[model samples]
Target: MGEADRIITLPAKLATALHGIAPGLITDTLAFANRFLPDPGGIGEQQMDGKNSETYLSNSLLARLTDEAAEANNEIG
Candidate 1:
């Protein structure tokens, strides 16, 4: 079968557990981001604001990583 046609079922108990924890996990992660990486939309904004060489490098690396991930996803999907 094609990947797109594949179906996998998860246990109902596991699905319920995931649903219960997902919101708080997401909220805590966002709270961490807000605590550490505050006031900047993304790498592009930080780079645009003349943050530092580190930010420029990070932006470039993130762009390359994003491109690579897209290519890999296209290959898989």
Candidate 2:
């Protein structure tokens, strides 16, 4: 999953933290997500282009820091 996807699936506490730091970011990510679509076909389904998002995220310092923190937390656990 991409950074946005990871953020979206975060626990409620983490989600709240993210919301406190950056208002509406989760909402924007959900808006771009392609799940729960009535029209799975080529009809009006707004899909977030994974390639573009991945590229953008790869260049994001915040994403890198978050990934490192998650890895460190996993190691501790």
Candidate 3:
């Protein structure tokens, strides 16, 4: 299936694979990001006044890995 179909329909399987791996990765990832200003692209909301640490990391980490995988798949194909 194409990437679009995977994105729309693959979450159940993806979640099963990714569920246990996310906690440690997310903890480390946010700790790493907190050293500096958050990226505009890293966060969902552009305003980003700084009260939303969990939301920031949640959106950023999901986005980072998803984009990375998509890029890798594009290269492979």
Candidate with the greatest TM-score versus the true structure: 2
Please write out the lDDT profile of model 2 over residues 1-77, one tens digit for every residue.
64455454458658778877987888887777846543443434677664334544476885788668768888423
Which segments of candidate 2 are over 4 A away from where they belong? 1-10, 34-36, 39-77
Worst-scoring 10-residue span by lDDT in model 3: 49-58
Point out where model 3 deviates above 4 Å. Answer: 1-19, 38-77
lDDT of 1 by residue, 1-77 (tens): 75423435556455445656796875676688788764545465434533233445556865677658768888424
Could you list the CA RMSD of all candidates, in the order they appear? Answer: 10.2, 13.3, 13.6
The models' CA-based lDDT, in order, is 0.58, 0.64, 0.60
Clashes of each: 0, 0, 0
Q: Tell me the deviation in Å of residue 65 in model 2.
A: 38
Clashing pairs in 3: none
For residues 52-76, what per-residue lDDT tens digits would candidate 3 score against the true structure? 3456555686668865876888842
Worst 10 residues of 2 by lDDT: 36-45
Q: How many pairs of residues in model 1 come into backbone collision?
A: 0
Kindly report which residue pairs in candidate 1 clash with one another: none
Ranking by lDDT: 2, 3, 1
TM-scores of the candidates are 0.24, 0.30, 0.23
- Which residue pairs in candidate 2 have backbone atoms (N, alpha carbon, C) closer than 3 angstroms, thus clashing? none
